[model samples]
Target: MSFEHVFKRIIEFMHADPCGNFRLMVGTDSQVHKRHTVFITGIVIQNEGKGVWACIKKVVVPRKMTQLHERISLELSLTEEIVGLFTEERKNELIEIVLPNLYKGATFTMEGHIDIGAGKRNKTSEFVKEMVTRMESMGVEPKIKPNAFVASSYANRYTK
Candidate 1:
């Protein structure tokens, strides 16, 4: 299969699989050189989905690797900065360059958090508010619910 087909299939499997738990980790194999190769580790674990999910939760790189890891982190962090600095048009331009590889796990990790954490403050209510705001922005009005219910839903889906 072509890379696009393989990528789509993997995403579909992750979304549709009833008994599989998958997590993706992005990193580089080597960092000493300029043209570092990006690596993606897609882990699948199926153990009533609990222990398997934990098993897949391992980082390939240690915290000590600062030079390249930090660089990648900064680049990832810059996405929202660029978005904030430019209007929607310029932001879309920047996204064109940056977003193509984001699913493959290339960008500053901060980008992910900023994309998720904008209006959400410290409280759980704040988190729901932020999520709802995003869904609204996407023309999706989600039903607001309590954290306990949301946690229970996750527990139900993943736990046996």
Candidate 2:
């Protein structure tokens, strides 16, 4: 099936609101290879920390990345695609279903988990601030390090 179909399925699941509380999470993780880099993005529908429904997309670059800016640019593009998958109309409908009194519309919380963290001495640390800002600017909440399970754990699984 196409990504659009998959996203719509998830959105329908959200509209059902069966689990009482649900959280939608989006995150990306990448691994460097000798000649190329493997990038994976994970979208998760979490059920109040009890369980989750997840999907992932992967892409492999043709060459190794040497610059932080270049790597971040690629991440940005992939992140945008994931965020853009949900249309405002569809999202509002789902939210309205969950919150009937939401005449002004509904608000759903999405956290974009970045694979980079400041707690470690890694290349990603230098880019933490930039990534946090990038995520905020895109209207998605940002998470990093141990708190970023969807990216660091869920998406990281597909990178291998």
Best by TM-score: 2
- Candidate 2 lDDT over 1-160, as tens digits, reads 5877777777676665543466778887777788999889888876564566788888899888877767766766687688776668656655555575344333456788877778666767878888899888877788888898888898888887
In terms of TM-score, how similar is model 2 to the real structure? 0.83
Model 2, residue pairs in steric clash = none
Error of 2 at 76 (Å): 3.4
Per lDDT, the best of the predicted structures is 2
What Cα-based lDDT does every candidate model obtain?
0.30, 0.75
Local error of candidate 1 at residue 66 (angstroms): 10
* TM-score versus the correct structure, for each prediction: 0.22, 0.83
Instruction: After superposing candidate 2 on the true structure, give the runs of residues whose Cα lies further than 4 Å from its correct spot.
Output: 16-19, 101-107
